[model samples]
Structures are given as structure tokens and as C-alpha cells.
Target: MEHDLPPVLSLDIGGTKLAAGVVTFDGLIHGWQITPTRREEGPRPVLARLFDLGRKAVAEAGLPEVAAVGISCGGPLDTATGVLECPPHLPGWIDVPVGPMASEAFGVPYALENDATAAALGEFRYGAGRGTSTMLYLTISTGVGGGSVIGGRLHRGAAGNGGELGHVMVRPGGRRCSCGRLGCLEAYASGTSIAERAREALAAGRASSLSAVELPTAEDVSLAAAAGDPLATEIWDETTWALGSALTDLVNAFEPELVVLGGGVTRSGAMLLDPVRAAVARDAMPPAARAARIEPARLGAGVGVVGAGAVAHDLLLSGKSDA
Candidate 1:
């Protein structure tokens, strides 16, 4: 029965882009296609475009048919009912029934997962967490998000979205988070926060090399910091400090064997990882610190699509609802 399952069509929805791929049971992807999300167009148009992307991916892969579709997107979503509640990234897109729509479009069942949770499963199954019993994954892109695999199983928690690791309180009464909370790790370590802090500093007229650039991004800050720009250094340090502090807490709490960091921010590689590693080594409980190794994600930019495909593959195997 398991061998009879068809390859899965996977879609990943993000604020900046939409990606689709045909994924086999082996966790390999083929016929991947990517396009800008252009979310200003609202849900109907975006979903239509997304479905079209799916069809294109299916056609490109030369598969006869796909058995299931798996969708991954940012949360505040209902995995049980497959409704996407107002995720802050996709502003003006609220309560869209993406799962049913995707299922209907494809004539197959669909599984919707929080992007980070699906990524965690992705890493656990095929990336850095492979063969490990417990692992954690964090994505530090436009926002910070996290998920955990514990006791050799994906942990979705009671809320369906397993862990809001980014929401960990790093500075009480400090910067406001998109979750409407103050002092969240996401408030400080996310790429958006890095750029905002740089912009705020520049707006206040702090003289720095970044002053010459308009709307610098986190990569810009990282590059500037690497080039010895003081302002960028400050921002980069604070970002790493926040990540280390939060990761220290998470490593202590979970005692995972590995922690995988992904997303656009991690492109800085050693610049981002070395400092966090140092902080965790210095601050976390000795046992937990010794147990966990933080590393960059192996799946790279395609993790979202692959993760969604993995979710669909799981659906085929289980024939049951997600946690």
C-alpha cells in the first residue's frame, strides 16, 4: 500500500515568494519552480497563482499524477481545519481556507503545516537531524520561528504550532513583537528587526557607512559588519546576542542533540553561527551545552517546498490527520 502512493505536489507560500515542487517518497525534489508572491494582490489571486505554479511543477516533473498536496506557510494557522488565520506576514489575507481550496484544485487530500514545523520535520527527516533522536530548527528570516523534534517524533504541541521559540522573552519590556508581545527574541534577532534597528539608528542621525545605503537589509548589515562598520557591528552583535541568549534557553529546555539554523539570515554562515555557538557554550547548562551542536541547515532555500512534500509523504503513510 505504501509503495502504491504517488509522488506529492508541495507548495510553499511566503510573503516574498511562492515555490512548488514535485517530491518523491525518497524526500528528493524535482521540477521545482519559484515566483514572487506579490501578496498585495490578496488571497484569491495569490492562491490562483499558487495553484498554477503547482500545475506547472507537476507538468515539468512529467509525473502521471500526484496523490496528495502539502502546503506550508507562516502561522497562526489551524492545522486541524486547514484555515490560515491572519499571519502577520501576509497582511490583508485573513482566514483563507487554503487546504480545502488546494485539495479541491488538485483532486487530492492536502496537509497544511506551519512552515517552521514542517521545516523542523524536514531537517529531522533528511537534513542535519538525520539519525539523531532529538533536534531543533530555527529560521531567522523576515521573522524568527522554531520547531522541535523530540523523542524521535515531530512535536506539534497542543496548539498545532509546536513551539514559538522566537517568542521567548529575551528582554522584558523591551522591543515589541509582531505577536503583540514585548521583548520577544523575534523582536531583536529577526532580519526585519536588524534592518529596522539600522534604519532607526540612521534616522536618528548616527553617522556610519550604512548611512550611504537606502533601506539596507540584514545581509547588508552583516556584510557591513564583516567589513568593520561600527553601526553594523553593533546591530550584528545585538542580533547574535539575542539569538545566543534565546538559544541558550532553548538548548537548556530541550536538550536536543542538534540545532539547525536556516533562512536568509544564515547566509552569513560562520559570522552568525560562531558567536551563537560561543554564547551557548558559555551560558547554557553544561550538560545541555555539551549535548547540542548548532549548525546551518542543509536543505537551504528549498526547505519549505521539501518540507511540505515531506508532510504530504507523511500523509500518504499515515492516512490520518496531522497533530
Candidate 2:
């Protein structure tokens, strides 16, 4: 059935970039293209460019025609209605009819999904999570976002935003989250938060290698911590602690077989993975800890494109879209 499915055009809309590719059922991407988002230009022009990029991808892939188009972006969104509802990353983009617009552009059926939820499906079907029935995926990038696959199916909670794992409370009444909540995981564990914390520390006159950099980022903090900078180490340690604490709770609650960590910040590799793994092993219930194997995502920078493609494939297989 998978072999018979036609290739689909996949589009990923992010705060910083836009990517497009034609993805086959085998999860191989072709004619991949990318460009800066320039989000300040607002939704209309950005969407126009996205559509053009999709056309270019289709033309370059040299396929007869795509079966469908899949769009993946940050949420809160209405999957059933194909509308984006004020996603934080895309400011001033409210109630955008993306699904129908994409359908009109490509003249094919379209399926829209939350970016993290789509990435979870991508990993489950084609990447690190293959063959696992229950898995959790966390993207620790500009903002922390997550999704899960339970019993081999994507779990898009009643809100259709997956579980919003990033919003899990880690430190009650601590740092404020973008979601207006205090001490949510995103407030402490996200790349944005990591950089912000380091900058705050430097601003308070704490001395460290980070002081040399004009604008220290999460990567800078990780590097400084690895080199034994005390301030950076403290910040890095706290970052891992928050992630570990939240993951321990999730592991106990979901009892997943795998936990995949993806996104830019995860590029620190062992620096991030080692401590998080150790914490889960030490704090989570024995059974849950033993069952969950924490690993890095394998799809790399193209995950969003692949994930969007996976969503389109599912849409076709479901027979809900005439494409």
C-alpha cells in the first residue's frame, strides 16, 4: 500500500525559515528547497513565497503530479478546520486558512498539522521511533514543543495540539513561560530560555567565557559548560535538571518505549543526552525508566519536511482526501 501511494509535496513553516520538498512514501525527500521566513512581512506574502517554493519543488522533483500537499507549522491550530489560530511563532497570523489555501495552490487535497505532532509521526514511521508502539518526541529548539505516538497512532489530544508537553510544570512559580504560565518546561529548558538565562547571569555581573561573546546563545552556554566554566555549568545543569524532571514524569505517566530528543539545541549531543538519561534512570519508576530508551532524533534538519510529508501520506491513506 505504501509503495502504491503517490509522492506528496510537503511544506514546513517556521519562525526563521521555510522549507519545501517532495516526499515519497519511502520517506526520501527530493527537490528540497529552503528560504528565510522573514516573518515580519506577515502571512500573505510569506504564504505566497511558500506556495511558489512548493511549485518549484514539484517541478524540480520531476514527478508526474503530487497526490496531496501537507502543511506543518507551530500551533495552536484547528486541524479539523485547517486554520491556524494565532501560533506564537507567526505573529499577526490568526485564523489563516492554510489548508484550503494550500489545496487551492496545488490543486490537490491538503492536510495541516501541528509541526511537533507531524514530527512525532515522521520519527515513528521513518526515523528513530520505527517499530516502537509508544514513543515521545521533544523538540528543544527556540521553544520546547513535543508530541507522542501511543499504541502506534499519533495522539493529537482533544485540543488538536498534541499534548503540549512543553507546558508541563517543572518548577512551580518560577520563570514565566511564553504561554503565560510560571515554571513550565519551556520557561527553563528551551533554547530561548537557555540563552536568556545565560544573558541574565552575565548581565548580573557574573564572570564567565560567555562574557566574551557579543550575544551568547544556547550553543555558547553548552560549549562554555563543557569547558568547565562555572556560571555556564550551573545554567547548563539547571537546564538538564528541568528536562530530566519533566521527562521522568512523562515516562512514568505514558510508559513509552522510546523518547526522542530533537531540534537545534539537541545538537549538543552527549552533553544534553547523558545527563537527561541519567536523571530519568535515577528518578523515574524502575519499570518506566527501563522501558524508555532516550535517543536523539535521526531525521536532522529535514525533519519538518519529512514530517509534513508523512502527514500527507496519512491523509491519502485515510481516504478522507480525494487526492
Best by lDDT: 2
TM-score of 1: 0.96
The lDDT, on a scale of 0 to 1, for candidate 1 is: 0.92
Q: Name every residue pair that clashes in candidate 1.
A: none
Q: lDDT tens digits, residues 5-124, model 1?
A: 579999999999999999987778889999999999999999999999999999999986898999999999998889999988899988999999999999889999999999999988
Q: Alpha carbon lDDT of residue 65, candidate 1?
A: 89
**Per-model TM against the reference:** 0.96, 0.99
Q: Model 1 off-target regions past 4 Å?
A: 1-5, 321-323
lDDT of 2 by residue, 159-229 (tens): 88898989889999999999999999999999999999999999999999999999999999999999999
Clash pairs for candidate 2: none
